[model samples]
Target: MDELNLENEHELLNSLETILTSECNLHEYIDDIPQIFATDNLKTMSHKEETNGENIETLFDKFPMSSNVSKDNTNEIVTLKSKCEELHTQIERLTKEKEEAFEEIERLKDQILSQSTYCTSLGAVLGNLTWRASRFPQIVDTWLSNFQSKIGEFLSIVNGTFGAFVDTYRSAFPPTSNVEYQFVMGLLGIVTNISASPEGREFLITNSSGMEFVQKLIKLMPELPLAPGTVSLKRLMLMILYNVSMNKTGLQYLLESRVEDTLSHCLDDEASSEEMQLLCLRVLQSVTYDLDKPKYIHNLIATIPIEKIEIITSAKRSDISNAAKQVIKYLQHSQKITK
Candidate 1:
């Protein structure tokens, strides 16, 4: 029994010595290692330590240091910081440019306001000159020559000023006054002559911007207390209507407004007079000839009292007889179609 115990004791000592030598070698290796860590590897080691309560410092102590990798990371951080500063500088430059553009817009607005005020003053001065020149033919002729000399620069200004002046002053004087009638008639006659020109005809048909003004003048016709013996306002109105009727557009308006209804009232009670009959015939012929439609002619026939038709039929004059016949034919045609 003593001999067996001695052998067992020797085996136990050898195993203890082997374990101590391995522990000493591992310690020497760990002490020689450096302190540098990879970011990715550090994250993994941190997770393992949290889960198992392991020491991360012991694992990281086995890795070696690298000065080259440390220097590269520091250089990357400095580059990113410099780029951010350049972007801030660009943004500041753009902000100043925007402020300068806004200031320029405000300056232009002030200049435009000053120019508009100056134009208004000049317009008033030109309007007085036009009104004065219109009173005397010799002065008007001279003024027109001067106007043509500066046509390109002042045409638009002249038209606007004179148009406003005429609108304001033309109605102030009575239509029966010889001077007023002459002024109004002379202008209308000139316009009519111009309208016959090729350029004027093209302007009237294509542009037609003056149509509203013509309609306003038509409405003012009844307001003029013109005596037939003195001024013949009716004749003048007829002439105006005939001129405008050259284009069917204005005639369509007269038809729609039933302006012909007023014609019978203008006829004198003394229908036997040649002048009265001729005037009545002319008005009738103009309406029927221009409109040339059954319905419009029927409306005119309806407005004339049947007694007036009887008077027209019994009239001895050939002109009056012809006018009555034309009206009767239109009425007959209208009734036949309605049936």
Candidate 2:
């Protein structure tokens, strides 16, 4: 029994030594923690770290210095700066592109504004003359053959009456009576109405007169800043000239005159309306209709652009739209003949 107590005492002494060694190791671990925090270069740490050192307990509570967390944050900052620079460059490029697009749009708007009147107002005049011709088919036929004597004697109005109409106008026009302009429009309207017909075209062509009256009528048209009466009279003259020019003889007659230059001068008239401009275009179409005449064809090609023509083809008025379509057709025909 004595031997058993001695062995048990020996075992108790060994267990006590083990307990003391564990206590020493724990104190060493606590002592090393502060040194690790003091030497670390982590910049995101609080002001306490920069001033002195953090509390020993707080040093362990935060992310560890050996975890590579600070390195990862540095990489993230660099990437964000690069992205900011790239975005700034993209914004500059887009601003330049937008400015260029706005300039192009302004140029296009100017082109369309110049042509808008022809597409809208000219259509009404063209439709009116066509309607009148269709309504009094027989009368137009009789008048076309004997314009001065047949219809002229009946109304006491004749082609020579246009000469007197111009005499009523002066250099200035603001105080002019608006009612007197109708007589000029009426006489010319009847002539255009008659000329627009197929049978009427035949009379103008076959009659010994053959637009001799029209050649004289063109000379009487007043120059620009035109009185209202002169403007109405000239518009009628253009319509008559356009109808006459639809034929080979009329085309030949016009090519021989300064009418092409006259039409250009009329177009340049600041006082000219869209209806006047449209009549000018119709006359141009007839004059340029002679595809066999290279001079006329070249004149047309030089005078108008394909894009401008394409824009007018969409005119809100059907007569203007149809006329534009016919103009485009003539242009295409001219192009093919040239090629």
Candidate 3:
């Protein structure tokens, strides 16, 4: 029994020595090892190691880092949302810019087309009229013949290019000579001649820019100096008004324009010649002749100077007296109807 006991103690010491030699290397880092099994109670050491592992797992479960991960995820989502909104705003701005660019392009295209017509076809016609002063009538006649069927189209050209020409000449410096003025006069004369015909009258009445052109002409008339040199200009303009009045539409436009007021002023002006007064009376006669509408006729009667017209009814010139008498008759009829 004693020998057996000695052998058991000797075997235990050898096992302890082997474990100590394997676990402790003094040449290596001490922090590389987590625990030292210093006791000979191996079973107790194993139990303690298991308890420590469980405590570590419990500590991690109590205070987890998942909330920081959640916050980071939320921040990332917010950043992405902001970027998306910025992209959307950029898209909207780009879309609006695209639409505006298209509108500008369309406007530019129309302007280019108008300028092209001004430089080419209509420009060529006006150039000929300006350069060829002697053949003015023939050129006008030939132009009318060639474009009579397309009067509406021709008037469109007049509205665009010829209108520009009139403005240019009217505003030109005196150093440019009287040719420009005469060119404008010639153009107005062409318009007057065009107004003489029924088809031409209708075009002037109904075409989109025709009455607008007439309005412009009337506005220009009052600005012109009605001297001996401008008598023909005034006469041509008055003749256009007279011819336009032959149609009901034309008459309405004239009455609304208060052309009677202008006529009355002309009659009252002492500087106005007998021929001008006669022409004025004739225009008044035309203006009152075709008035089936009582309101327009009434407006004319109310607007014109009745006493002045009555005084002229007994004038020396038969034509002037006759025209005054006709106007008086129309006014009397209108007054009787109103009563």
Candidate 4:
């Protein structure tokens, strides 16, 4: 009886060892858990043992404990555990990214709201198309068309001076526009677009008061106070003259006015910006273009440094180099004159 009990105990130990070894190799045996377990021959609870030479053979083919997990089920459990941990880490990372996305969204929403409020206020005050929030530049173009139709009335209101025009323009933008620099910008927008057109160029030349208007602006240049507004105003005025000097009639007026010397001085001016220097150079180019007018050319060569002109010949600005090259080309073939 004791020998039989010992045999049963030895068989139980072998079965447990076989089950543990099978668990270790579970991954090699399993891919799909449910299908494998369903179709497989499950172990039964009936006694299963074979002995030879006092040794009991216990392996998966013979072990019978129905509750014990199959190789496929063990592998599936390990894979499911790994997948769960990966999902947990991904969820944490996604949560942080979602928080950052919401912060950017809120900042953009605030910026949009602030701009919307500003545009709304601008709309309520300036109801006319001339002063619309996005299209205010259209005001000058409209002013140019109107001025062309009623030149005398337009001249009368400003009284032939830019200062008067500036004062009247402030009423169009009103105190709410809040930018003093817009004054010069408003005036520039009108003349710049007009000056670019052939029809507009003809109008300025044919209109009896056109040169008179230009002369008044030139006369105004010397008298401008050395203040911020005046400096900007002068720059815009120079730009107007540069555009006007595109044709011979206008070029003749500049040479006859003897603005060449004044323009040469403007090139040397430290207070004025490079844009001012460029316009001054362009006007000089126009004045010197009439080879018939060598007197103005002589004055230009005398006052401006030859090296300075050379420096402009290689200037970073395309417009400056273009005008400077014209002057240099003109000088290369000119008669010898004492500076």
TM-score of 1: 0.40
lDDT of 2 by residue, 1-339 (tens): 133366656664554454345335434533543443454322322233223222322322432333223455435434533443453354445445656777899998988976754543354365345446645777666555666455434223434555454554545543323434444455567667767776665555455444556656555443534556456667767877887778676667666664656776665576877787678777767766536667766665565655666776786877666776787788788878877
What lDDT does each candidate get? 0.48, 0.57, 0.62, 0.56
Ranking by TM-score: 3, 4, 2, 1
Q: Which one is best on TM-score?
A: 3
Maximum-lDDT candidate: 3
Model 2, residue 260: C-alpha shift (Å): 1.5
Better of 3 and 4 by TM-score: 3
Each candidate's TM vs. the true structure?
0.40, 0.45, 0.52, 0.47
- Model 2 lDDT at residue 205: 46
Candidates 3 and 4 compared by lDDT, better number:
3
Regions of candidate 1 where Cα sits further than 4 Å from its true position: 1-177, 191-210, 226-230, 268-280, 289-298, 305-307
What residue runs in model 3 are displaced by over 4 Å at the alpha carbon?
1-150, 153-177
Off by over 4 Å in 4: 1-149, 156-185, 303-308, 311-322, 336-339
Sort the predicted structures by lDDT, highest score first: 3, 2, 4, 1
Selected candidate, larger TM-score, 1 vs 4:
4
Lowest summed lDDT over 10 consecutive residues: which window, candidate 2? 48-57
